[model samples]
Target: MSPNRATTIAIGVGAVLLTSVAGYAVWFDYRRQTDKDFRRKIRKQNKKVSKVVEAENSAKGARTQQDLISAIIEISQEPTPTTPEESEKYFMENVAIGEKLSTLGPDAYVHAATSFYRALRIYPAPAELMQIYEKTVLPPVFAIVKELIGIANVIAQQSSRPAEAGIDGGEGEEDEEAMIAALQAAVAGAGRE
Candidate 1:
């Protein structure tokens, strides 16, 4: 065979091998990227499913507002006092009801708010008591009330929508904001009195 022909054949073989290797690398990279994306999507879906299951489990054991109120009333059976010192003591004893209700999550906010309001009703109107009320009791009550308002707004929006459009239509952002503003105003008014 001629040297020139042998050299040409060698060049052709080298080119074919290089092209095959490049093609295989590109295909492998594409497959790897696709697999990574699929795994990420599956992880996200699993997280969503787990959250739904957790909510369901929690709801199974959740207590109603009436149940909470009844429990509070049962625990707080002390007679109403006429003296300021006794009233302060009574308020201090029942303050834990608000804290407990606050821990019950947003579903129990109405009950929590009611408990706080009741505590305030019997509280002595002295200046020192007012400071304690504002500093200690008001924040958790306000927070629970705010959460209740938000939940109510969400429910109202969901109920008002057409069933075909799905439960949470994502159109209640504005309504939620307006409701929050209203709740803040109402809470502030209640706090002043």
Candidate 2:
């Protein structure tokens, strides 16, 4: 082969090798960065989970009825102002209280119900307080917890049934009307009580 042709072929092969190495290096760095980011995110999430678990455990250990009642009171007294900020604050505060309430077990629910009924007696029968309790607070408190270790099918079957029979997912405007009527009836019943 001519020296010129040989030199040209050598140059071409070296360029190809250099390009391949550069491409692989770039890809490797990109993968490493993505993996690092993913690991950092996972660690952050794990810390949050640990915090929640710690809080739940501490709350369960305390088991103070006063704490439960106080949380409930905080939830109930959120301002009913017409402003968006007021409404958002109310929702956020209630969500925090709800999370705390979930940490408390079944006994806490009974106490909550008793406390609610007692408050109902004092609050001049069927007030906004009672309405909130019936609609927002009571349903979640009364939710039944099932421990499913090995019973996957059983859990699936149980979950399929709606807690309230009259309510179905596919109903449209008629469902809304029915819900309103039910609420009105509930308010009337509470007033009578």
Candidate 3:
């Protein structure tokens, strides 16, 4: 074969090899990213499932509000910590329980609020711990309190509204206002403490 032809063939082969390598590299990178994303998604889903299961398990034995309250009180009464780290750990656990209880239903709101309150009560008075509590813990606790108040208001309204004509208007409005005020006071107290 002519030298030019041989050179041309060699060039073509080299080009094909380079192109194939580049294509394979791109494919491999894409697959890697896809796999990473899939794994992340699966992990997120598993976390959600585990949380749901935990909530269910926690709720399984407590059939009544009194039982739930007793359980929460038991949790709150567990040994207090002397160190900030232990305090923070317990605070987080209580907050998590409160969050889970908040999801159960409006009936559980009191227990949820109590849990949050216990966390606040146990929180260390140090500057750093206070800051962390204010930043990470306060918002959710306040939110739960507000939610509880709202639910109470709704329940009061539903119950107080007359079902039939000429029925006496129940003590709905006053009770709702009182509950809201009490909740607000509790939240304020928690913030102060």
Candidate 4:
């Protein structure tokens, strides 16, 4: 090849190499930023869930008569769920607590449920705790008990679907259900025992 042609080809190759390196740097920077953002989001979610778990745990330890009574009074005196919407709100919150309590050890479940039952005694009216007991407490407890259950039903019906699905089924499924059932049955059977 001619000298001029060789120099032009070399210059073209150099430009392509420079462009490739620049593209890679941009991609690496974007990947790093994305990872950092993802980690930050996870940390935030963990903090929120952890706070709720901690509150449930603290509630578990308050077993004394006065302590239990105080919580009951607080729940009872709180404005009764005046509307269906408000009742639903309370019920959903209870569901979350129930799901968490179901995963705690036997003692934790006993304490949590005992606290729940005592709180119910204070606010047994259909207004708050009773409604929640029926709505939130029972269903998740049942779900916690029955792992063979489905999520949206359709997803479960998909013949090719996985053996496990969603939050209800995964690595934590067995342990979570066992813990929840043990706590529930223990607290439930306490009066009989």
Candidate 5:
């Protein structure tokens, strides 16, 4: 095109880029100045680490006890959706809530675990979901979730076996007991760490 037209286009593009950069700088500066939690944000440039991270580690350290049993029980008591579509939606929401709560601190672990457990209950393939949890969930939270699953399995075994039909369920009970014991040991070891 003409020289003047090319110059005008280049100037327009440069002005647009410059304005966008200035807008971002103002936003970043305002947040850095006014947002209290901004200082604790985890970034390459962030110097101060948040207490939430410390609290999460401490929470993992303090998971030696059986307090999570009550949280699991409470989660089980909460109403769950019956339909498949509703269950899917519920599962997504709980997982999101669990992830959000996980970043908060130690105090939120129980609530986070509760949310995860709720989602786990409605999942189509619980074992698969649990495997995913083992990889992605916090160690302490995963331990609690494993314990919850162990308890659920034991309960399922008990109900299906019944008091009189104890013949077929013996192996299941043995396996469940072993799993529960292993989970308990793992949790205790995590606390020692």
Candidate 6:
């Protein structure tokens, strides 16, 4: 075929494709503007997808909460450092590990928090160390550590109460029970948010 003839055929094909595309666009726009059933179907589909996404997120959230609770419980159950030298060394190791893990990102937050909780247990003064953590630690990790401390306190109180009751002839039992109740409330409140 001649060059002019080929060029004419190409332009004709191009024009046909463009016209078809523009015609489809106009039809789509008109359907969207005037078709109530079509619009409602789209909305329903979107709502369905949104509900599924919400369900999945809620499932993930439930798992995360359970994991946090289990981690706190496990850390509370672990044996503690017995001697001053052992306590200091354990504290330093855990603090260093926690600090390093905290930098690795969100997926490592639980491990980091557990490490910090371990160090806090052996620290010479936990309240002061916590103040330092507040300044230096990531917020999520800090929150986890805080929850662990509360739950550990509850566990510690429960264990000691039995022994102390035996020793004190049951004196101050009410105060002990009240303190346990208060710590439980704090732990529950912290987990809510």
TM-score of each: 0.32, 0.21, 0.29, 0.28, 0.46, 0.60
Give every collision pair in model 3: none
Worst 10 residues of 4 by lDDT: 147-156
* Per-residue C-alpha lDDT of model 2 across residues 35-97, encoded as one tens digit per residue: 987678767999999999999987763443233333333433443446667655554554455
**Tens digit of lDDT per residue, candidate 1, span 1-193?**
9999999999999999999999999987787678988668767999999999999876752433223323333333445668988777767655667668777876665566656645655765644544564576547566543444343344344346525224332336674444344434443444466
Name the regions of candidate 4 deviating beyond 4 angstroms.
Answer: 1-63, 114-193
- Superposed Cα deviation of residue 189, candidate 4 (Å): 22
Q: Per-residue alpha-carbon lDDT of model 6 for 45-86, expressed as tens digits?
A: 999999999999999765665565556656666888899898
Provide the global lDDT of candidate 2 against the true structure: 0.49
Candidate 6: misplaced stretches above 4 Å? 1-35, 153-193
Give the clashing residue pairs of candidate 4, or none. none
What is the alpha-carbon lDDT of model 3 when measured against the actual structure? 0.59
lDDT of 4 by residue, 1-193 (tens): 9999999999999999999999999987787677987678767999999999999877654333223333333443466576777766665565466557756755344335544543343343735545555565545343322211111122223223433222233345574444334333333344265
Q: Which candidate is the best by TM-score?
A: 6
What would the TM-score be for candidate 3 when compared with the true structure? Answer: 0.29
Which candidate should be chosen as best, given lDDT against the real structure? 6
Q: What is the Cα-based lDDT of residue 169 in candidate 5?
A: 30
What does each candidate score in C-alpha RMSD?
17.7, 20.9, 16.2, 19.8, 14.6, 8.4
Against the true structure, candidate 4 reaches a TM-score of 0.28
Per-residue CA lDDT of model 3 for 29-63, tens digit only, reads 78767798767876799999999998887675233
Model 1 weakest lDDT span, ten residues long: 65-74
Better of 3 and 4 by lDDT: 3
Give the per-residue Cα lDDT of candidate 3 at 157: 45
lDDT of each: 0.57, 0.49, 0.59, 0.49, 0.71, 0.78
Candidate 5 lDDT over residue span 1-193, tens digit each: 9999999999999999999999999999899888877855735334334566777767864463345544553565578798989999999999999999988987787778778989998899988999999999999788777766665554454446455323233356575455444434544554466
**Regions of model 5 farther than 4 Å from truth:** 1-66, 155-193
- Lowest-scoring 10 consecutive residues by lDDT in candidate 2? 144-153
